[model samples]
Target: MSYKLIPPGKRRNRHYWLRGTIAGERVEVSTGCETRQAAQAWAADYVARLEGQRVPGIGEVVAFERAAELYKAAHPHLSKSDIRLVGAVAKYFRNKGKACHEVVHADLVAAADELKPGRAASTKNRKVIGPAAAVLHYAANNQWCTYQRIEKFWVSRKSNREPARDEDLAVLIANVEAPPRRKKFGRKADYNVAFKRLLLLMLYELGLRIGHLLTVRWDDVDLRAARLKVRIPKSDEIASLELSPVIVSELANLTSATGVNRPALGRGVDRRGRLFPWTTNRGVHAWLKPLTDRLGIKYTPHMSRHKLATDAQVLPDKKAAELGVWKDPRSLHRYQHVRPEAIPGRSAATLLALPAPDKRKAS
Candidate 1:
C-alpha cells in the first residue's frame, strides 16, 4: 500500500490516503487526520485488508515459463545462445514461482539457495540469473508481473575471484601441446593444433570475439608491418594489433596449406576467418577445457583478454594507461610501475604491439 500525505488545512485538519489492492480487491483508506496518525492508521488497515488470506495475490503469480515466452516474443531476433538462455531462465523462474506468498526477504533468500546448487558459477550465474532478472525487470515494467525484479532476488551474491596466473597459463599451454586428444595412432595427439586453437589465439592476440573473427578477410593482414585489423564487435572500436613475424608466418602457412579456402577469405575479401574452414566457439571451448584441466589451469576465453590487459600494463614501453582501460585517464597512475609478466617463451611474444586499427580507409 502507498500513501498520500496532505498538509494541515486552515482548520488544522489534514488528509492521509492509502492506495493499492488486497487479493485483487482494490481498497482505499483515508484518515482525515495528521500525517503521523494517518500513516499508523493505514498500516493497521492494511493488515485488516489481508486478515484471512495466506497470500493476497497467490493465484495471480506469473510463472517464469510464461514470462520467458513473453520475453522471447518481445525479442525474436536475439542471438541463438541468448534466446536459448532466455528459455533457460524462464524455466528456472517457473520452478521458483511455486511460492504461495508475495516476494519477501525469505523468498529472495530461498531463490538464492536454489541457484547455489549449480557447481559452475558462470553457468548458474551471470549467464543465467542475470539475464533472468533482466526479463523479470522487463515484465515488471510492462505490468505483466508483480514482483519488483532485484539483482539479489534471482541470483546469489558473487565474490571477487582473481584471474589465472601466468605460471598456470604456461602449464595449460604445455599440456595442450604435449597431450593427446583423439588418437590417430596409438598415442594421443595434442588437442589445440586444430583450427579452434588458432581462433582462440586470435582472440588472445587481437581481442577479437567469434562474431568479429567470422568477418575477417585475408587482405586485412599486413604481414610486412606485422599488424592486423580487427573490427571489434558491438563497438566502433576498430583495433589495430601489432603481432610478431612468427605469428604472421603461422597464419600465412595455414592459409597456404588449407585444402580449400572459404569465399569469405578469398581474394578481394575484407575480413579474417577461422584458420580451419569450418568451426564453432563450442568446439574451441570443448577442446580447450580438457587441455586446461590436464594442466590444472582454470582458463577460459576471457583469460586471453585478461592476459593482454595485464601484460600491456606491465610493458616497459607502454604507457600504463594504454594497457586496456581506454575510457579513463586516471587508471594510468595505478599501473604506473607494474609490467605484465613475460609470456611463455613463444616466438609470437617477440611481435610488436599494434595500435587500434584504422577503419576509415574502408569507407
Candidate 2:
C-alpha cells in the first residue's frame, strides 16, 4: 500500500504525482494536489479503491530476513569484521519475520540497547547499530521501507587502559631467557627468546593492531630500506612504516640465527611465512602475559598503540594520523591515553596567581 509523491516533470502539469500500484496495475497518476500530505491522502484513497482487488506489483511486501540478505549481498566490499557484524545482527532478527515497513527506529534502538550490557559504547555502535542502519538504508534505497537514522553510541574520552612504557618494555626484553641448546646433531636451534624479544619490540614500535601484528609475513619486511609493510585488517589498507635501527637489528639477528625468513615456530607458518608464527591472536596475548607479569607492569597489545599515538601527538595532526594509519584525524582521540601530568602545560593552579587584594580582604 506504499506510495510516493513525485514532483512534476518539465512537461508542466505543475502538480504532485502519485506513483505506486492501484488495482493490480502500476499507476503514475497526477493527484492534482499542491501539498504532499494531500497527495499522500489521495494515494491512500487510490489504494482503498484497490481493496480486495488483489493488487499485484508494488504492493508486494518483503520479509526482514530477505531484505537483510539482499543488503549484505549488495555490499561485497564490506570487510571481514563488518561482514561478521552484519551477520550477527541478521541472526538476531532472522526469527522475527517483520516486514521492511514494519521495522522502525525504536526497533533499531532496542537492538542496539540489547548490546549495551555486554559491550562498550563504541563496540555497541560499531558491531550492532552500524550494521542495522546499513540494512535499513539499503532497504530504503530499494523503496521497500523508509530510512530512519540511527545515532552512533557515544563513548567517553577517558579509557581505563594506560600506555605501555618503552622503559618497561626494554627491561622485559632484556630479561627474557636465552634459547636452550639443540639436542640433535646438525639440527639448527630455534631462537624462541630472540623471536619473542623482536616481537615485543615490533609491537611497541610499529603500533599495529593485534590481528595485523600476528599475521605479518616475512616478505613484508624490508630491512635494507628500514621499512615494514603492515596489513591493517580493519581499514583494509596496507601501511608502510619506518623501522628504527634497534628494530632492524632485532629482526635481522632473529632471522639470521634461525637461518630462515619464516618464523621457526612450526605450527603457524603459512607458505608465505608469518613473522611471529602464532596460530591465533589469543596465543600471542597468552605468551606475552607471563613476561609482563614478571616485569611488574600491566600490558595489552592495544597499550602499545596508545603509547605510539601518545608519543606522536607532538607531531602535526596529519603526520600523527599517517603514523597510526588513521583515515580520520578525529580517530587520534581513540588511541591517545596520556596521563594528566604528561600533558604539555603547567597546571591552571600553577599558571594563574591569586590577586594580592584577596589577602587584604581576608585580613
Candidate 3:
C-alpha cells in the first residue's frame, strides 16, 4: 500500500502515473496504461521486484524475450556460438509473446524442431533447447519464474569415426614435407612446406582444439623453457603445459625461419600475432580435407584432440583433464574412445585364453 496510481490530469499525459516509495527509494513513472486499475497492478509488480518479493503471477507477466536478454547480459563470457544461439532463440519466442514461466518441455522441443529442421538431434540440442533452458533457468534464479526442466533429444552413437592414428598423421606430415614434383618452384617452397609441417605437428602433439590452437599468440610460447600456455576457449582458463623435445625443436626452427625474433622478457611487444595463418576452424578443416582425401584417411583436427584424450587416459583423471584443459574431469568421457584391444589385461585374446569354470564346483 506504499504505492498509488495517479489519474491523468492537466499536467500529466493521458497514461496513468505511479508515484510512491519502492524499496526505500522514491519513484515516479508512467505506468504505460490509461486505466487506474491497470496502472495499480503495474506499480504493485514494480514495487515487489525492488523489495525482493516474488511478483504475483510473474511468469504470466514477463516475456521469454526479456528473460533471454537478462540472461545474455548476466553471462557475458558465453562463446560466440552460444550467444548466437541465444539470440536466435530469443527472436523465435519474441513474436509468440511466450511468457518465461509458461515455457514447458514441449515448447522447447517444438522450437528446436522449427529452428533446426532436419538437423541432427545434437544440433537441435546445442542450438535451440540448450539456450532456451538457460534463459528460463536464469529467470528462475531471479524469482521471475519457476525453473524449467528440458529433456534433450537423444543422439545416436553409431558413428564409425575413430581417433586419428599416429601413423596416419605421420604420413600426412611426410606428404607436406616432400618436395614438389615440378621444378617450377624454387627454395621458397621449402619454407612454406616447413610452416605447414609445423602446423600439423602442433595440432596433433598439443591436442588442442582447432579454435584454441589458431588463437595461440607468439607470446604464449617459451622456446627456451620448452613450455607454453594456452587459454582454453570453452572455459576461459589458462593451462601451462610442458612441450616435448620434438615440438620444441620444430618451434625453434619455425621461429628462425620466420625471421621474427622473440622479444626480450619484460619488453612491450605486440602479443596479438597468431602462430597459425588460419583464423577460423572451418579454414583449417578446408585446408586439411584435400590432403586427407588423397591419403584415404578420414582424419580431422578434432580427431587429434580425441587422440590426445584417449592416450592420456593412462594417467589419473585429474592429470588427464589438466593436459586437455577440461574444466571438469567427467568431460574426458566424451573425448575418450579407447579401442577394446588397447585396454590392458582385457584384450579379446586374454579373455578367450582363460580356462572354463567346472559345472561340478557350482553344484
Clashes of each: 13, 0, 0
lDDT tens string, model 3, 174-207? 6654334456564444345555676777777676
- lDDT-better candidate, 2 vs 3: 3
Ranking by lDDT: 3, 2, 1
By how many angstroms RMSD does model 1 differ from the true structure? 15.9
Compute the lDDT for candidate 3.
0.70
For candidate 3, the 10 contiguous residues with the lowest summed lDDT are 340-349
lDDT of 2 by residue, 107-136 (tens): 766777775567777877777888888887
Off by over 4 Å in 1: 1-65, 92-112, 115-123, 144-149, 153-204, 207-250, 256-273, 281-302, 312-363
Could you estimate the TM-score for every candidate?
0.46, 0.66, 0.72
Error of 3 at 248 (Å): 1.2
lDDT of 2 at 168: 60
Best by lDDT: 3
Error of 3 at 69 (Å): 1.0
